[model samples]
Target: MREKNHVRNVNNRNEMEAVGDYYLNNKTLGKGEMKMEAAMKMRIADIGDEIVSNKGIKGKVEMVKENSVIIEILENLSDREYVNNRTVVSHKNYVII
Candidate 1:
């Protein structure tokens, strides 16, 4: 029984390490350096500016949170429905137009 438990623990640790390596080195998974088109930072004053996602979702900034912005999705690009249709978009995942 002890040997079985030890083997299970080893397998779990190996699986966790493999997952970590995948996240840190997989280019397809958005690892490593990223491209930034603009160097300007998003401020509270730019809350009303139009923003777009890579997936073509257009929305206006409703609120700004720590490291993310709350957008009231104005278009019908997404199928999911929420109360007033809001989504928390990451600052890196969107562009202010």
Candidate 2:
């Protein structure tokens, strides 16, 4: 009885823990544990800069704001969920291509 319970617990724990897979791709994540891209902070994004959003929406930067940038949708690699031609994406949500 006790042996069977231990086996189940072990299996469950193993399934829940996948910590070392690229750090970002993990099931066992704690607070403040994150890795940012170098281009996200170092690169200066500007108007006409091509970027791909986190959701795989490809677009050009139409305007730049303090926190986010206005993008004109050029190509959507994901799906047709985006019904608008222009979108506002945060700096953290996209990378300049």
Q: Which segments of candidate 2 are over 4 A away from where they belong?
A: 1-35, 38-42
lDDT minimum window of 10 residues, candidate 1: 14-23
Candidate 2 local distance difference test against the native: 0.55
**1-97 per-residue lDDT for model 2 (tens digits):** 1121111112322121111111122332232232244232435469998876655567889999998999998876554466789988888766565
Off by over 4 Å in 1: 1-35, 38-45, 78-84
Give the alpha carbon lDDT tens digit for every residue of 1-97 in model 1.
1121111122221121111112112221221221132224333315786665434356789887778788878763433456766777777766565
The candidate scoring highest on lDDT is 2
Note the residue pairs that clash in candidate 1: none
lDDT of each: 0.46, 0.55
Local error of candidate 2 at 51, Å? Answer: 0.4
Top TM-score prediction, candidate number: 2
